[model samples]
Structures are given as C-alpha cells and as structure tokens.
Target chain A: MEQRRSFLKMIGLSVLGTIIGRAIIGREMLWLMLSKLTKVQAAEAPKQYGMVIDLRRCIGCHACSMACKLENNQPTGLVDGELETPNRRINWSIVLGREDGEQEKGKYPLLSKRFLPRTCMHCIDPPCTKVCPVDATYRRPEDGIVVVNYDRCIGCRYCMSACPYGARYFNWKKPDLGRPENPQVPVRPVGVVEKCTFCKHRIERGLEPACVETCLGRARIFGELSDPNSKVSKLIRERGAFRLLEDYDTKPSWYYLPW
Target chain B: MTNIEDVILNQLTKTTKRFYAFIGALLVMVAWGAFAWSIQLTRGLAVTGMNIPVYWGVYISNFVFLIGISHAGIAISAAVRLLRLELYRPLTRMAELLTIISLMLAAMNIVFDLGRPDRVLNMVFFADLSSPLVWDFISVSTYFILSTAYLFLGMREDLSRLADRLPGRRWLYKALSAGWSGSEQQRFGQERVLRWMAIIILPVMVSVHTTVAWIFGLQIAKPIWHESGLGPYFVTGAIVSGISMVTVIAWILRRLLGWGKFFTLEIFRGLGNFLRAVLLIYAYFMIAEQVTIRYGGESASLEVLEFYSTGAYAPYFWSFVILGTVIPFLILCIPRTRSIGGIVLASILVTVFMWVKRVIIIIPALMHPVLPPGIGMSTGIYAPTWVEWSILGGSYALGALLYTIFMKFFPIIDLEIGK
Candidate 1:
C-alpha cells in the first residue's frame, strides 16, 4: 500500500515538474521571439558599403572575375597540368550569359544576349550569418559588410545552404596557387567556406574593390549607400536600379541598372 | 536452472567457428573504413564526390537514417512498459541496444562529414543559439545520455543475477548492478524513476528529429526544404524507419540465438499490425507533402518536384515508392503474408529503401538550387566516391560488432522481467 502510494506521489510530482518546466521554457521562447523581432531595427549601421552595376556598359570581358581571383589569391583551378572542373573551381565573381528573351521563345532576329555579373550581395540581413552553427560568419557592425572568420569555421557548410544567391564556395581541396600569392589576402586553408568580401581589405584601406577597379567598361560602381550624397546612391536613384530576388527580403546592398 | 535461462544463456558460455569468422569479417571492414577516413583527412573532402550546390551527399543522408533508426528502441520499450503492453516486453532490451549502437554511428557520420574534424569542439565553445545545428547537438546528446541511463537502470536486476552465475566476469557485473538486491523498496524506487524517464525522453526524442529537420526546413534558400510540415513529416518517417529496423533485428536474433519461444510469432504479428498502421500514416505524410508542393506551384519547388517525378532522380524516387512503401504495405496488410518470414522480408525492404528515400530527399533538392547554374558551371550531379562507400559499409560492420560483443556479456532478452 505504501509503495503504491509513493509511486502515485512520485508520478504526481513529475507531472507537476513537467508542467512548470514547460511553462518556463515556453515563456523564454516567447521572449526570444519578441527580442529577435525588435533587434532588426537595431541593425542600422552608419557607413553601409554598397555597389551599383550598369548592365548596359558591361562588355563581358571577364576582367572583373580575373581581378577578383588575383586580389583574393584564390585557387588557380590547375592540378597536375590539368584545368580543374568549373564546379570545383573557387570563383568569387563570374559573369553569367544567357539569351534574354529565351523564356518567351522570341524569334532569332528579335532575341538578344545579356551578361549578368554575379557575386555576394552583402545583404543588410544575411541568412548565412544566422545559420552558422558557430559565430564564424557575421556582418561587420560598423560598415555592414558580411565577412567570414576562416580560422573559426568548422566547415559544416550550413552557411552555403542558407545563401539564396549561390554565392558561397567551399574549399574542397588544398588550394593550388600557381603564382605568388598576394600578401594582402589570407590564403584560406581547405574545408572552410569563402565568398566575396566586397574586397574588405581594399575598402578599409580607402581603395575600390578589385572587380570595380578593373571593370573594362566601368560597369561596376562602389560607394557608401548610407550617405545620400554617395555616387552609388545617386546612380541607384537616377537609374531606377533593382536588386536580385527582391521577394526574399534580404535587402541586398548590391543593385543593377537594366539595359 | 529454469529452461528459459538454459536456452538464452547458452551462447554466453560457448563459442563457435562461425562467430569467429563473423567477428573477423566485421573487423576487416572497420579497418578499411578507418583507412579511408585517414585518406580523407589528409586529402580533404576532394576524395568525396561533393562539390558546390550539392555540398552534402551520402554522409548527411546516413546521419539522418541512423538517427531515425535510433528512435525505435526507446520509444517501443517505453511504450510497452508505460502502456502495459505485455506482448512487447521481450523485445525491449534488444530495441534499446539498437538505439545505443545506431545513435553512436549517427554521431560518427556527422564527424565524418566535417571538413575539419579537429575543430569540432568549436560547435560548443562558440555556439550560436539561433542555429538549428546547435539545437540538434544539444537535443541528440541529451537523448543519448537519458537513454543510456534508462538502459542501465533497467538492466540492474539482470546484471545482479548474472554476476553469481558468471564467475569470470563477476566483478564487472557486480559493479554494474550497483547492489540491486531485488528488495520491494528498491523495485518501487526503480519503477518510479523509469516511468518518469520515459515521459521525459519521449519529448526529447521528438525534439531531436524535429531540430534535425529544422536544419534544412528553416533555410528559405531551398524552396522544397522550407516547409511548415517538415517537423511532423520527419518525425513520422523516423518512427516508420525505426520500427522497421527493430523488426528486422528482432527476427535475426530469434533465428541466430534459437530463442524461438521468447520471440514468438504472436509478438511478430502484433508488431506487424502496429507497423502497418504507422506505414499508412507515413504514406499519408508523403502524399500530403507532394500534393502541397504540386498545388502551391512555386517555380523552385516545381523544379524540385520535376526532378523527383521525371528527372535524374526519377528512378530512385519510384524505387522508394514501389519497394519501400507500396510493396511493404501490401505484404503487411495481407493476413496470409503477415507471417514472421513475410514480416522480416518486408522490414528489410522498408529499412533499405527508407535510406534511399533520405538520399532522395537531400540530394535532389540540392541539385536544383533556386538560382540557375552560371556560365561554365556543370549542373551539379553527385556520385559518391569509393572512399565514401567504404566508410558507409564500415559503419554497419562496426555496429554489428558492437551488438555481437554486447550479446556476449549481457542478457539481451531481459531475463529478470516478464517471466
């Protein structure tokens, strides 16, 4: 009788404990949700670096891509006298070419080709920073430039999956640099993710990003987005520029002027 | 000695040539796997077939599948004890054993997938609370510890009983038993503790799988993976796969150990009925998922659906439907074919194809990224390398070795209870 009574008492206590525990956790989660909703307002940085690309002026010379590779000291895509597959190559910026009216099946005479230079958008609200299991990737609070701490990344690649633009690249193998690596950029070890940093090193030193500087047609423009007087702001306002995948609400700092 | 003990404990006292051969083969596979891992660590993830876009492949699928299998043991054991399902009492210990071994393997697969395994501790030291992976880490580890304690506590009486009989390992058993003397007071205390643990562990198990699903589901980047229904869908799939694994393992032990009396056909029949109902629920989830994706008509999701229905993954997707779901469901439904042999074959099919389903879920969605494949880039077709296959095979071999060694030391059939 006593054993049964104790068992019942124990069961009752456990039930009560569970209810109390759940209530506390529930309240904490509610508080967290509320806190996150309010924290978005606090993300307004003073000097928001941004880019404005003019598609009409782009010549598709691939100079920006080359310049980016040289500036970042990325892999050369050469292994044992063989060019590595394009998928295996680490490219931070590339110009994508497609027939503009192909989706509508426009007639050959009316159809026109276009080039879209793609890179990390450096969103004001970055999904990559949120999904990183460690704080290896984060947005710089002062300048609003998203960057990765390569030394701290565990190579889980959750950030890669979170980026909607397919902007992130994983170092599959030890990077083989055929030329003398630039002393300015750190040669990231294999296994961590890498992407365009808006040439943060160059920007910090008061110089344009390599891609912006080396564009053959001067299609790429760079300046402070936070300042209304900045060249990027004036171009965006005058040209009626648009961001990619605006539906995603990432608020990309990068913009493009249509041809 | 009672007839039950004589039959069940016979294998502990004796060794056979076949057993030695089996252990040898398993060790070879494990060694091969270790060698492959060493190569991967040195050469980097280049050894695998993974690249950009399809950044994850076989390793992640194996991790999910193994974790799915780990859920059945504790769930079934807890349900049996808590709900007074006496017919399932015989299967509890083996189910719990499977949970421990498979959970270990699942955790190992995560490490195997890591690019820098040496820096894994950074997940804890520099943890991000908002990340779903951290939630998965915490929940899975909590489940592991709780289940381990639950398994050990339940084995106390059996361990104490075996200590006196097995003179060679008397000290080991005595230490493990922790002076469990079968007193009324002790039994009452133990029962209360176990009951509480069962209640606590059930929620943790659900959270573990849900968090795993959230790792993909929360990513708005992938249209197919980002869905509100993913949490329940993953939980249902986990239960189905876990139950199938338990059925297969239980049948194998029944044959190998010659414990036909303990693992009766009636027990299998009950399990079959239970599995059939769960399988139906799982089938419902699959249909609901497909219907929602198709009807929503989101372009990215449509592309993923197209990839599964009529694209590169069509063969694998249909195979899972026919072999894993439909055929097994048909076999389990028919009264004549729901016998022990039929159940085992159906279970084997379900277990194998469920893994195929996981691969299909992970790889195809990745292959069809929202953005188009840019200039000069290949359309990201993934094929696992020999090293990956070898490691996968080695993980199973290691699991089998653990189970085999455990059977040698302990009573796998729970001799103290339901006698």
Candidate 2:
C-alpha cells in the first residue's frame, strides 16, 4: 500500500511536470486540438441550423406520425427497445389539452383539443446525446438533432432515461419491416434505440416533413427559424409559443401556444 | 501428514453431481429466456405492454437493479480487504464471482429495451464520443474487465496449491499458477497486484453505479430520475442491497456445499456488522433522496414524482423503501438482533425489496407521461410480456449456471477446506 501511494505521487509529479513543460513551450497539441481550432481562422464553419414546430395549428390526425412511419419504416409503436401498448400508438404521438372548467354550452364540447404533436424535443441542451457510452447516440453536426445510429448502440438504454420528454425509445425486440422498406428512415434492429428527427429525411430531400404537409388543421408548422420571413418564424412572432419543461433550459424546437 | 508435495496435487478432481444439477437448472432457464427473446424479436415492442404514456417498463428497471446487485463484489472484496478484515478471506472468491456474473447479466438485460441488438455495434463503427451512454459503455466494460483480471490474479496462488490433486488438470493449474512455487516473492507480488486492484476497483465500482444512475440522472424526465441524489444515492443503495445478496449466496453455499467448516460463524458475525453499516448508509440516502425530491419542484418534472406516494405503483414503491431500507437497518443495527439468522433474513429482504424499489423508480416516472398536444395520458399500466418475464427468469438461471460451473472447475472452498 505504501509503495502504491509512492507510485501515484510519481505519476502525479510527471503529469504536472509535463503540463508545466507544455506551458513554457507556448503552443502544444493541446492548443491545436482544444484552443485554436474553434478560432475560425483555419476552418470554415457551416451554419448551426435547426427547425421550429408551431403547436397551435396541429390536429390530432398524426399525419407527421404516419409520414415518419412510412418514411422511416418505424414499426407502428416501437422505438429503441420499448414496446408500446396498443391504442397508445406513437413515433410522434399527439396530445390535446384545454383549460379546465370551460363548460360545453350546447354544440360547443365538440371542439378539437389543442393538438400538440411531439417526438424528440430536439433540445439545444440535449441530455440524451451526452449519456450514450458507446456513442451510439449523438447530436448531428449539420443539424441540431440528436439522432441514434442504431447499428452502434450496445442496447444499454442510458439515453432513454436522459430525455425528459420520453422522446427516445429502445428496440427491445427485433423491429418488424416490409421488404424494400422506406429508403429514408431505416428500420432499426433489436437492441438499439431510435427517435424523431424532425423528418430529417424529407428535410434532406428539400421537402417539408410529411406532418407539416398533412396537417389539415394547419396546427403543425415547421421551418428554419433563422430566415425571419419563414412561416414558422411568422407564427412565433405573431404568437408567443413555448417549449415543454422550459425550466430545464433544453431550448426545444417544438413549441405550443394557447391559440 | 501429507507432504507439501501431496498438498498441492488435490485440485485435479472434476466437479461432483451437485454442481451439474445446479448448472442444469440454470441452463433450462437460459434456454427459456432466449426463446422468449426470439419471440420478442419476431413480434415488436408490441409483445410488451409498454406504451407512449408508460414507455419504459420491467426491463429497464431490472437492468438498474441487477447492476446494483453487482456492487456486492466491491463492497466485499475492496472494502473488507482494504480494512484487512480476515473474516472476508474465505468469502472473497464468491463475492468476486458474484460481481463478474451480475455485471454480465446487467449488460445483457438492456436487450429487453433494445429495438435492434444487431446494430449495437454502431456505437463502435460510427460512434458519438459525446454521449453519456457511451461513457456508460466505457465505464462498465472497464469495470468488467478489471474485475475479471483481479479475480484471476487473486485465485492464482490457491489454484497452484490445488494442482496435483486436480488429477487430469495439472496443466490447467500450471497455466493459472504461472508456475507459482508459492515463493515469498510470488506472494508479495500477487498481494501487491491485489491491493492495487482493490484500491482502484473501489472507485471504479462506485463510478460504475453512479454512471448507471447518470443514465437516468442526466435525463430531463421526472422528479425521480432528475435529482442530484440520483448518483450517490444509487451507489449507496446498490452497495447495501448487494451485500445482502452476497450474504444470501454465502449462506446457501455454506449449507449446500457443506462449506460450514470453513465458512465459520466468525465470518458470519463480521458480515453481520458490515452489512449493518451498509444498511444504515442506505437508509440515510433513501430518506435524503425522498425528502429532497418532495421539497424540490418534483411536480414540474416531465414525469410525475408525487404519484409514487399514492399512484398505482405505490405499493412497490413504499415496500421497496421498507424492505430495502427500514426493515434491514432495524434488524441489522440492533445489538441483540445482529445474529446470523437476523443478518440472513435482512439480506434476503434487502435483495428482494431493493428490486421492488428499482421497479418503482423506473416505471412510475415513465408512466407519468408529459402529455403532448393531441395525446391524452393513456392510463399507463404495463404487464410485462411473457417474453420479458421469461428473459428475466433466464437471467437468474444464467447467474446460477456460471456460479455452478465456476465451482466445478474451481473448488468452492479451498486452501482452508480441510483445516
């Protein structure tokens, strides 16, 4: 035990010595990798892009869900490994809410619940992307979406717990599929996890997400928020929309409004 | 008296029938579980009752619980050994055994949550270095590897002594012994490695559990998962729960294998004291976790927190607190109550109760969905599919199988067996 302690001291001194030596040398590999790269001198930086979802226009029809399923070949109700109870179907499940105590006078109770279509919240501060040990899950570079590279996941389900909104799902069993499946959203295998991508497939092909196009209620809205004239931008400017679990500071792209 | 030469020759003997019978039972369970998993594969997550509202279910909870159970190895091998507590000498082997098997079991159990196990390697092929799950993979795999090597080195000297008696297995002993002649230098070198490993393993094992908690702690999910207490609290609960599992196994091994002569009452008394300490620490943390959650903005969490106190999953929750915490502490801490019988009972309770605790922690939070625009909270009640249950049963069988095989190849009680 005494010898081991001495060995630790020796290692510690060497590490300190190395650090001091590097400091005296001005710039080391550390400077190149840690400091200088982000200075924007030698490297060209692409846009840090994202999408905005307007909750006010969504109807509960699940056009986005069906589109994602057809596009991604997502089995009816499973993502990652978790199995869904029937009738609780989702990929992008929809929720409708109303303020309490609004009595339906006569023909009034037939109002459509305010549709809130949800999938991966795609938070600016993504906790789900940080906890995957094998790096099977990550935030994509071109876009700010935390996507699962199903082939690499060791099936630990660490990301499942990290997402506050229950956005991620695991492939607990082998995923079912039709042959020559949708080329865009690859049906994942059992033992990996998957989640919503804001219809990255359609977005990649220069098309609006199936959900955005399919919304008969026009409640589902998606677009680049950076282009101030975008429809999503126009709506957000007109009505103050908010994300879920705002206190966590996840800075989600999906937002809801009372209108 | 036998010569020193004769003493070293005894380990060659093959394992007896009792070992085979034990392993046979475990194999049957593994087979059943694998079959169930296959069924789950053909069908989808639809086989299980999990849904949008209650997304995670039994499988995720079991994964956490089993990892906690694996903490027994560090508590026994590192803690007791570091203190130079001689009572742990006879039991260290089994505890180490428990760690290796439990780690494997916990890793595999995650499959119950995977949509695609085939692509599990995507983590390696095109990986994301920034993910917490990635860190979890690296940490757990490291723990698994280090523990295995440590166990191997620790058992080397003993295996050397059992060589000649091993009959047809002299070469097996020779390889493990690295031709150890039990010289003072060899003992000193082995001891050096063991001590180093124990020192490093203590932190590694603790970190492993903490990382497991981080898998949930990092989540923005609910009050239960998103707490500062999630890390240390989980580590404490795991160690406490783990010791009891070790105690139960020790008791069973002593009785079934006629190991009583070496697994003495002194060891039992020492284990009792140690387990009591574990339980006390656990109780303190359990209370701290609950109190902190209750006081914090538990309601605002994406998942419900207070629901645990009165919702559908309440019994499993309270019972876990009682069984894993209250009862075990009360039994083990009392002076007159710290008997072998008391310890054994508490051990059994902690193991079973802590499992219930794991379920409550995982399911209730998951069940309390943060409803979306069109989605109403489906009354999230999930009864695990038959495949899920079978896989769980199979896991227990896998553990038992490994233990039995280990005993067959390596004698259950050695060195002090006949003394």
Could you give the TM-score of chain B for each candidate, in order?
A: 0.98, 0.91
Query: Model 1, A1-259: lDDT tens per residue?
Result: 9769977988899999978877888977867755642225338998899999998898778899999999998875654223245777888998764444432334678754567898999999888888888889999999999999999999998999899988898988788888999999999998899999999999989999999999989999999999999899999999999998888878899999988
What are the per-model DockQ values?
A: 0.58, 0.40
Candidate 1 B-chain TM-score: 0.98
Mark the regions of model 1 whose C-alpha exceeds 4 Å error after superposition: A1-42, A79-83, A98-112
Span of ten consecutive residues with least summed lDDT in model 1 chain A: A97-106
Indicate the worst ten consecutive residues by lDDT in candidate 2 chain A.
A36-45
Per candidate, native contacts kept equal 0.69, 0.56
List all candidate RMSDs to the true structure: 2.9, 5.0
